[model samples]
Target chain A: MKTQKYIVIGGSAGSFKIIIRIIKFLPANFKKTIFLTLHRLKHVRSGFVEALSLKANIPIVEPKDKEIILTGRIYLAPANYHLYIEPTKTISLSTEELVNHSRPSIDLTFQSAAHSLKDNVAGIILSGANRDGAEGLKQIKLNGGFAIVQNPEECQVLTMPTAALKKSQTKNIYSEKQIIEFILNCK
Target chain B: MIKLDDIINFNNAVKEVSSYNLSDYSKKSLGRRIEKILSDYKMTIDSLIKKIKLDSNFLEKIIKNITVNTTELFRDPKIWQSVKYRVLRKLKNKDTINIWHAGCSTGQEIYSMLIILHELGIANKANILATDINTDVIEIAKKGEYIYKFNIEYIENFKQAIQVNPYNYEDKIDVSFTKYFEIDRVKNLMTAKPFLKNKVVFKKYDLVKQDNIFAEKFDIIFCRNVLIYFNAKLQKRVVNMFADVLSKKGFLILGIHESIFGAEALKYIKHGEFYIRR
Candidate 1:
């Protein structure tokens, strides 16, 4: 039996529609545990999960603190909190000061996944206006995990993926369709 | 790199040398905190362990740094709005409403509650007890002073929770900031007025020990944003402890994203963002 894979997808400004498309594309039986950390307004908390869930084939959850990690489900970072992937296979939320001017920071979640799961992780950085996910993608590569970014030309906002490409040496840049194909092709 | 083994060793060393028991904290969060401490101080794990063994004062500072004290007034304004309409309104008829703020950090939350209670016209009937493991934070909570500019953004939360009625857009109540706090921009200080700070008692208490020092049952308990530091097992234990001390049909208010799970969750009825003790 193969070990489970942890897939982390991070985005900001322009990645929501793309995320919905990805969620719509993935099959219900997808075995990898998916973690989504998106930059969101701290006060507006209710609509994001519900909107994402409308077309999702797999279960989408904004996980509570210390919730057990399970395969075949998507976990979202709640607003105004930093989400961490624990070594004990549980999720932990932190109210620490914001990093990169964002809570549910892409860097925190990606770095945590890299540190805890090592080579069993795949970190994907998508379109955004800021440089929050850049160092995190670098950490993912440094930890022997797969680091991927959407191609800058294909991104709605090029700063995020471009920064990620400059920081992380990984050559696994993909278009939206190619990213979906890459996820589907994973064993 | 600080591994899980290093965290385990640190926990054991702290347990043997002091009254603190950190073995129950979530390893991933604790490990991250330890790694930050090591980098901040430029010390190795072995050196950190040696300092912990030799100096009790340094150990206390390390323990204080380990616990997170981040908080704001009227955090998650919607929850406060729910508290005004849902929780406190239900308990308004009682002669004395006892509320416990477990793990209350730097006093903003307590003041936030006082503002709500005052607005509801039930401030005088409430008795509040706030506690935390960190003595430094307890003192800050006692002082009821904070950096004005640092917390200026949360004033919007005040307007959202107190001034504007969510259900009715036309119904608006004008509440002044001067009613609860005195903000001095020149000095960069916001001090909670006497009426808000006088009703609450502050103390140093550790939730991990499961000891109820007050020996009094509470009508409502606020343990917001604190349980995320503990593992599932410890979280369950603390939830059960809260269940034991809460009055029948009392409320347990956790953080917006925090939850009670396992057998302990059955003791409370989930109502919106909070749990009602059954």
Candidate 2:
């Protein structure tokens, strides 16, 4: 496999709806890796994966380290782990330390992906608080990757997407459904 | 006297900082910070608002400079390394090990943990909790992918620092980092596909809000490098939040550079780069 193209989705406050919308819009046989970061408590047991899996046309699974990157699989960052891509195209997890008081932090992932994935990637920042992924997304755009942001007016919590749009050169700004279409089309 | 217009700008800045909830923060200090930001950007209050309305990029730049960021990958490697050697042996019989990577950034440290656990053969049996105040970073972290431009030369140094074989792993894979990641043809741009979202449950959380943090306890709350940003009182308060939510005897790994020195914890144990259970 040509190391499935990577799509990163980040959001907070009201990301649940956006994430599901994207999953629903994706083609059943979409051949890319979908990584998502949502805002939730560390200890709460959420049916997020199950919920998304049911709605998504593709298989949704919590990723495992060294698991071969496959096409058509949707992966979520399990609660409390910073998700990173290794040079080997294998998943690398870190227990390092929080950035902006968040683990599966947006900056950490986006910065690493910008450093590793380069132009073969797509980054989207959704409704959220703080400016976490702003710098990372900036790096992504600077690295020739496609950057997108949710229209702030459309977000329940516009801090994140607004911040991203403010700092980086996003290739497109869309509603959740449009974002999914863009990703699918890109693939 | 502070300019009336400046005061308005400061209020706007404060509103932005706390997401329009400046009721809790001190106006004077917040205003000073905002003034500094405005001056640095060479923007008038009117210009600033215009930028916020017309240019989202300017807003992000202001936010990045104003926000406090405390992050490090494998922050306290020793604590994690110890967990691998000492704790794993004792907890081996347990079917699963749930870890909370509290405030996990871009997931670098989380990736390190996953790599270590996978090497330890304990990953399949583990569940990770990656949370952060910045959902932007968390979303990016979920990608599990990174670019290695400036850091490419550090591959050997990173391996040496972490005592892992970066080159050896490449030998097993058919694709080189260059194959999947698109290196900038000109500038130092590098980006790659994320590989870790499959295993993490990323969420946005505000530690200041008790409701945001659930009523459950965790086996390990690896909160590192983030405490330094908050004022001392806030740090203590946040530590209490961790202490309240942590399972008894469960480890709390802080950044190697951070210390719980005089927090409310009964006591702390140092293991490598982290400070563990009380």
Best by lDDT: 1
DockQ of each model against the real complex?
0.75, 0.03
Candidate 1 TM-score, true structure as reference: 0.92
Chain B alone, candidate 2, TM-score of 0.68
What overall lDDT, based on C-alpha atoms, would model 2 receive against the true structure? 0.64
Estimate candidate 1's alpha-carbon lDDT, on a 0 to 1 scale. Answer: 0.89
lDDT of 1 by residue, B185-250 (tens): 999998999878889988888898867576677899999988888877898889999999899989
Work out the TM-score per prediction: 0.92, 0.46
Model 1 CA lDDT for position A169: 76
- Per-candidate RMSD, Å: 2.5, 21.6
